[model samples]
Structure formats: structure tokens, C-alpha cells
Target: MTTSRGGDGQSSVEVGTFIKTPSAHIVEILAVAGLDFAVLDAEHAPFDFGTLDAMLIAGKAAGLPLFVRVPDFQPSTLLRSLDLGAAGVLVPHVDTPEDARNVVARCRYKAGVRGYSGGSRSSGYGEKGMLAAVADAESVQIMCQIESIEAVDNTRAIAATQGVDGIFVGRADLALSMGLADSQHPDVLKATERAIAAGVSQGKRIGVVASSLEERKRYSDLGATWFLHGSDQSLLKQAARALVRA
Candidate 1:
């Protein structure tokens, strides 16, 4: 298979369904369970910098690339996640070109103007040159969430942004964007399928946030190569209902 390098031109690795959760130990456990990458949910989950750092350390120790899903579009949040040693940062609700551009900036050092600290998991905790490590890792993976009509309309431009390595689609918010309280119509699936088509055509890795594995497969045929498999907090509940139902 051909290796697809990120903006940094480093090893282009394939990641499986990365579930969100607050525990670093669980992150490590999942890595051992055979996941290429794992993301710490800093966006929707209750977690602090200290906890995030520990997760990063655990993920790295387990030889898994760690990503952070930040809560918002704040550049500071994006930079902090990278500086703390996250392999990439996922920003949610990216609707405009400016939003895409600004989020991408957080992946750089000098030009990115990120606040740098060498003694972090990214630099091996002071064992490496902090600035260089960050610059390299900054370009690792910048996943921008596209979950609205606004984002869907600007989908092409967002994927074409300089620092973006992949596109993540949040269907629930997207459904709302289309003026539906929740998507039960084929129209939502059509919109998502279109987004995936755009992503594949642009050579960008397309990802989806599925409520379940079966739901994700619906889009897998549409060229979705990545998935957010399960969340740490909800995996059992999901499995119980989906796989172990009575």
C-alpha cells in the first residue's frame, strides 16, 4: 500500500475507530487491543491538562499515536494539545475557511506561533529538542470536524486547507444544520455520502463519527477510511445494545 504522509511528510499511518474517553489507562488498553491511534476527548469529555498529558504518555508508551479532540476552535486549545505531545488535534465545528486556516496554524511552530514547552510527552519529556519535535508533530494530524450545512457547503475548501490532514463528519449536528431536529431522512445520508466523495477526490482521508459500527459501515462503502469506533464511557452500553442484546 502507498504511504500517505501528513503535512509533515512523516510516516502516514492508518488509524482505526478511535473512541473518545477520559482514562489514559483505557487509552493504553485500547492500543493493546490493536488500534493504530486513539484520541483523548478534550472537547466533549471532562478532562484537564494533567489528565490529558497522562493519557498522551500512556498512549505513547503503548506505541500508539495519540490525538486530542479539543472542545473548540480556540488556537490556544489547539496549541496546548500539540505542545503537550498529542499526535494531532481534532477541532469541532469548522464551518468557515478562516476557521480552517486558524486551526491549521496551531500545527506550526514559528509561523504557527504556538506556546512551546519542551518537557512534554511530545518531546519525550525534555529528552528531545522541544521546538523541532513540536514542528514535526504539529504537522502530524489536524482533523477538522465538519458537522453542519455551513461546513458541508465549504467542504472542499476546508479539506484543501494547508494544515488539514483529514476530515471528520459529525452527522447529528449536520442533521440539525439541514433544519431537521434529527436526521431520519435519506437526505442526511446523501449529504454525508457527498462529503465523503469530495474528500476521496481530494486525496484526503475521510472519517465519520458513527453511533455504532453498523452505522459506520453504511458510509464505509462511500469511501470513509477512518472511524471513531467507540467512546470509553459508552462502549459497553453500545455493545450491550448492538452486539449482546437479549
Candidate 2:
């Protein structure tokens, strides 16, 4: 994880990568790259439960903090991901304070309604014991995705929600909300700026997906600390296309 100035200015940044496929090789590569974390894009990817669990196990073996981008804010979805040993969860389409709070509640054992299970993989299959599993649940990070116009409008409240660890700006979705195809448009940039400022005001870590190195620098300048470079499939396709041309 490369350290950058967080929205709070005092806090540091955490860098991560996103993967669509549940591939152990890809998880190992992320570990070798020394990324602070890796997120499995379950929101967009059709990952079967078995594959997802295997990927999480692979990530643990590699000592990489693995997170899951659940398709929705459903408690069961969050619970399943955590039960499988995810270090954290990224909840999509969190448009209001209530949404943010619900996510936190579902993620944390102390605050949320996540079911307790000591025999789960997160508890080392009963090796760590129930007490340790409870502690782990409390420590699980909850990142709320700020994407739509409503979410941008409520950024401050969302960031201030207790148990919410960070805010992730979904640039593509934000662009769609603004009726633009390009996330780099001025309108999207302005919205992201506002979201970042709001998150910073509350001392929350702000994250964004950078389409390129330039975009990463741009978001960093705006006080975004967590940077997700892109997805595994995209990178693989880009490399293959280049090789074909060469």
C-alpha cells in the first residue's frame, strides 16, 4: 500500500487492485506486487460461492488483505463475504446516511446484525474461537460507495456514519448519473471533488478507481487516499492486445 495524503491530510492512503475473476494466480500476483489490498468485484462479476471462497483462502495464504465488493447492501451478502474470511467489504450504491449505517451494521458484529458463526473460515474454522471471531468482525472495514447524485449530496453524512471506515467514489456510476459516458468529464470531476471534500471534512479515507496513472494523480491531488488501479480482466486484455500488435 503506497502511502498518500488522505482526505484528513493527517491520515495516509492505501492502494489496492480490483479483480473480477476468482483466480488464485491473480491473487498471488497482487501479493507479489505488494498492494495493500485487493477487492473481488462480486458486484459485476459472476463469481460462484465456491470460487469466491477459494479466492479468499488464496488471498489469506498470500498474506494479502482481500475485500469483496458485494452486489448490494443486503445483510446476507455482507455476512457471507465476511464468513468466507474477507478482511472488509465494499457496499455499492450507498446513497444516503441510512444506507451507510445499514452497511456498517451488517459488517460489524457489535453494531450490525451479522450472524455469529465460529466455525466459519474467518474464525479459522473454529481455531481462533468465537471470541476471536467476534473481534475480527468488529475490525472488519466497511467502505461505502459514493456514486449517484444522491450519494454525492449526502457524502458528509455518509462519511460521518459511525463504523464506516471509508468512502469509495464510483466514477463510472457517477458519470452515468450525470448523463456522461466519460468519467473524466468536468461534471464528474466536480462531483468527485465535492465528495472528496465532504469525506475529508469528516476525516474519512476517500477512494477512487483510476483509469490511468494520470487519473490517479488527479484524484490524489483532490485528497483521495485509496486508489484502485483497475480490474484484472482489463489489464489482461490490454497486455494481450499489445502482444498481438507487436
| Clashes (N, CA, C under 3 Å) per candidate | 1, 1
What TM-score, over all chains together, does every model reach? 0.85, 0.92
Q: Pairs clashing in candidate 1?
A: 43-71
Mind giving the per-residue lDDT tens digits that candidate 1 earns over 1-246? 123556965434445555456676787678887876767887777788888878887877888777788888676787678777777777899998889888877667756756667776566667778656755665568888889888888888889888788788888889988987766568887888777787777778788866666776676667676777657657757767887565
Q: Which segments of model 1 are wrong by more than 4 Å?
A: 1-21, 211-215, 239-246
C-alpha RMSD values across all candidates: 4.1, 2.5
Q: Per-residue alpha-carbon lDDT of model 2 for 83-158, expressed as tens digits?
A: 9988888889999999988888888777568888878998888899887788867778788999999999999999
Best by lDDT: 2
